[model samples]
Target: MIRRHMFMSALAATVALSGCGGGDKSTATPTPTATPTPTPTASPTYTAFPLAAAAEFNTYSAAISYTGDPATSAVTLGAASTETLSTRVRLATDTAVATGTYVMRENTEESRFCVPTGQTCTSTLVTPSAVGNPEFVFRTNDATTAGKFSQVEYLNNVVKDTSSNVPALVLNRVSYASWWRGDSTAGQKRLAYTAWGYSTVYTDMPATGTVNYSTLTVTGRLVSTVGTTTAINKVTGTVTMATNFATGVVDMTLTLSTIPTGGGAPVAYGTFTAQGAIPVGQNQWTGSFVTGSPLSGTLAGGFFGSQAEQVGTVFSATGTFGGAQQRLIGVVVGKK
Candidate 1:
């Protein structure tokens, strides 16, 4: 998540602007106002790990938390703070995966994570084609805390769809859990614990036009759990990808048919519409949308993988349901 310190900094800037230009101008040489020193903002710190020998690809998921206040000193997933990093890391070489490093820096732009643009972070990778579960640790450097660390675990697997002989990554899971000591006098507290699973199999859109505009049709089971009750419904949707291959820009629109409520009255959930973007060669797309007509609530999340491959596509979303504002989290796995 984006640190709350950004809001604080914006507030400080507003105050500074409001106080300026009202002071009397002296006839003597005016002393230039000294620039205020910028306060340090919390960012994610990562520890590099060597890749396994037989690992060709991997997926990672991580979460972080801090003690005391989150404004000045906080921890978060890098770059895509709103969404956890659940990316597939492709190895570059036949050698063992080399150690890669990342350092926390001040936040500047809303989208980019580190400050001063390109000089903010660096990474090194060595490739191999093996798979196994591994764990990593990261240390934090901030004004209010020391010795804070974040841990991540990865579970890897390969799955082949019965429809196609091509094997794709599937059923991979990552767990992020951390504990940190905020104050010197206090004990460490559990910071965060979250798990995410994904599959490489995705709904593929058929080639349509000159630019290769495509539409993907997916039919799957949607399972949702709220409190102690669970519901399952058949889901059908089509995703249209408008792609500009030259610029590597792609936008997607999703339309879902009505879903069953599984209630005694047998009321059906309303249709839903969502929009998302697919970055260049990245395997994930994320966006948000609102429910239509009789249903009211906003939903946000993303789909993993691309349309070119017939790999299983894993989707996850979190939002509220119905007028009662019931919290809902849903996951859909579509495989041919």
Candidate 2:
């Protein structure tokens, strides 16, 4: 074998070399873990994650509540009172929320004082997206979400007057739960809770001590055809208004019908009676159901001196307001 040798350099380059007997290559350490490598094999990939993500596409509703210290002066006792807020929201997934409206009532507790005492409070919403002009709009705050908690925002549009002890109007975010039912689910609504996306709400109604708190209390009925493809919903609601401060009488009713797609098929209808003081510069109205038949007419001969306008299929309801009889008329033009 060739003689091994070591060598050293005197140059300032500091290069050094050694000559020695040839030795076997040093051993390498055995790695505790094998290097993971992505194999180029074929297997079925799951889409469940994306499928679950699609859950956000459905309709969502949430309840909300918040508190506000009414800005008041000594002259106004309830003016700077404590006001509470309640509201609901509906939205399509991933699309900035659609129209949000307050659920106004005829006898919300808060409205009584704001409208004047001894009156019932009422709630209303700008459905049909045609409230002409909305009374309030809220910009949700960065609210923490647990389970079923939606977003939060500050509602600035509704405010208690400087002369009243009322709460400010508040916009309500929604709390949402989801369920899935397809032809495959076998009529089962697979419900699931979402993390940090839900809330409860009460309309922040301003009212005095006398009538009900301001809130929407209407009944809704949804009738759907097989497969839930075609739905029919009818809504009837009422708002009771306070009579004069002396009379202390208030009554009003409202009926709302929505077909989801208007004229297509109604998914719900709401109707109720509300009682509260009329808004400033507004008239108080009431309603009642008088005796009337769908298919009944009297002979013209029995009319010694009577006049009745030909009633439509929708019928009519009459009530007395301020000791004066009042009448309200409605018609069914599209699909029920």
Candidate 3:
């Protein structure tokens, strides 16, 4: 059963976001038996996470919990003070997520009961819901160990690229939602994981409009494994998102000469920056490097926009490399 009670502003999310959320991962899967030991090689200087990649996932951390029954077990009256209660909790199974149109249902929870007096019973219950935020970051990979979880790449947002830098007006906004199965190892090991997120970006950037070979929208998420320093408790999947404009430019081709494994990989530290010229009040000028990924949806008062600029017109962007082995992909459209 789900119950909504008092709002606890003091309570943060429960899930843990490792590293900064973005991570570089090569196509090669690590051998599960041995610690990855790929040899490091030289790669491009600029970087980006492969499919929602980030270096912060390697270092970002968090903790969370709820004070309710996981529903997987029944609360048996203790004959003495030494009896134990056994149950499993599922986060999504205990949640009701919907608004007006779409109502998606994904269950999370399990229960069990025993009196220790030769009596046993079984029941089902939804796990209480909980979650936490994580630091959002992005990093890239090379031909070698691009996606292994080690000392990964991240954006040194604190440092500005000489080419262009400005105060964070809207700040970067990112969020996420995740579900867990009861049979998972983490739960079996008395562990629980909750996934949640948010971001602080500069002032929101106005649409520079749409261009050929480009996309525009503003929604992103942070995803990574959660566990202790010794072992991985929960292996997180990809945090998919759609962005027509994620600030700056993405490289078109990234080739890796060498690959590294086991030890930490190299990193590229810089900025993912971009700015567009949109006509505000006709002939007037106002612009901002995009603070969020711009996506295209239905038409509203101001949903779709279009704009273009000549190539090699001195439209410059900058980024950084965490190590020697980082690759970046950028795309530029419009005639030169």
Candidate 4:
């Protein structure tokens, strides 16, 4: 009944007994191994923790410009040589954010060369989480004037107020100028303008007897010099101060304006007026300008928050604009 070559010989003997019982074998594809390349690391440098001196906790200044033209060389501030300075910043941190080396110390003991007592001033700030306006570079290496070096251009607008105890008024703006290289005799080149302001903490003032007579109103920004022409005029607007504190005085005004070097619009400088006196328990004050035509200069400042609301100032003056002889300097801040 089954007889077709023995039924194909039983199907070839069941496929040779299923290939001798160990079937399923067909593998040949493997050769991929090459991934080894990674090496690059070097970027870290820090050294900025050393600053001490506390009062209202930070703010110091020195001014003595108006002596130039006898040069042995050196003395060039802004526009040509007008010199300006201003500051009233308060940044505090022990550990929340504020990494090393950003200091501005001043203790001229009486030698005063713009920080020179064994020399060591530092500034390398740009990391409070960095966002906007955070520039600093206040260097000093004039161990006593040899090649004579001193630099400062610190600008600040920092505002990190994580629920305050009051220490975030940061409005710093400085650009320094100093000179006295041993001979220029306007009394040896007296252009000594020094400044210092920094803090870690220590603020509490406003209670000399608690006499709040009130009047206060302030505003800021001015940066001068235009008419004896070296052209360095920033003078935008707003000075409008008016502190009375019950006749301790302080009366300021300066409509102010500028902008025109070929740029169209903005011109109308000075309404100027100044007067000062406030010292008994002192919060600071000192003035002179009386009118304004470069009438001559002098103005000092003080008072900030905790019921004084805010106010900071600085000034220096000169005369004759467009007639050939002018000079100026400024700094201001305001509120209430």
* Local distance difference test, each candidate: 0.31, 0.22, 0.20, 0.42
User: In terms of lDDT, which candidate is stronger, 1 or 4?
Assistant: 4
Question: Please, what are the lDDT tens digits per residue for candidate 4 over residues 1-336?
Answer: 569989799988888877676464766589989988887543232122122221222443434343333233222332212222233322222221233233333333122112222344232222232334332333444454454433333323322332112122233321211222233232222323332232111133343332422232122222333333245344445566666665667777756666665677778766778778766566566777785444467766666434454555566666666554445555555445
Residue 41's C-alpha lDDT in candidate 2?
45
Residue-level lDDT of model 2, residues 182-244, one tens digit each, is 112112111111111121111121123333223322222222222213232333343322223
Query: Cα lDDT for residue 218, model 1?
Result: 33
TM-score of each: 0.30, 0.20, 0.17, 0.26
Q: Return the candidate ranking by lDDT, descending.
A: 4, 1, 2, 3
Q: In candidate 1, which residue ranges exceed 4 Å CA deviation?
A: 1-57, 60-236, 247-249, 257-268, 278-285, 290-321, 326-336
Question: Whose TM-score is higher: candidate 1's or candidate 2's?
Answer: 1
Candidate 3's C-alpha runs over 4 A off are 1-105, 108-172, 177-208, 211-263, 266-336
Candidate 4 wrongly placed segments (more than 4 Å): 1-70, 73-100, 103-139, 142-148, 151-303, 309-311, 320-336
Report the C-alpha lDDT of model 3 over 1-336, residue by residue, as the tens digit: 123332332232221222333343535676788778898754322221121222121001111221112233321111100001111211111111110011112223222111123333211112211121122221111234322111111111211221112121111211112221123212321111211112111122224433332222111111111121121111211111112333332222111111122324422222333433323322111222244312111110111111211111111111222222111211111110
Once model 2 is optimally superposed onto the true structure by TM-score, how far is the C-alpha of residue 118 displaced, in angstroms? 56
Highest TM-score: give the candidate number: 1
The C-alpha RMSD in Å for every predicted model, in order, reads 26.8, 28.6, 35.9, 19.5
Candidate 2 lDDT score at position 86: 18
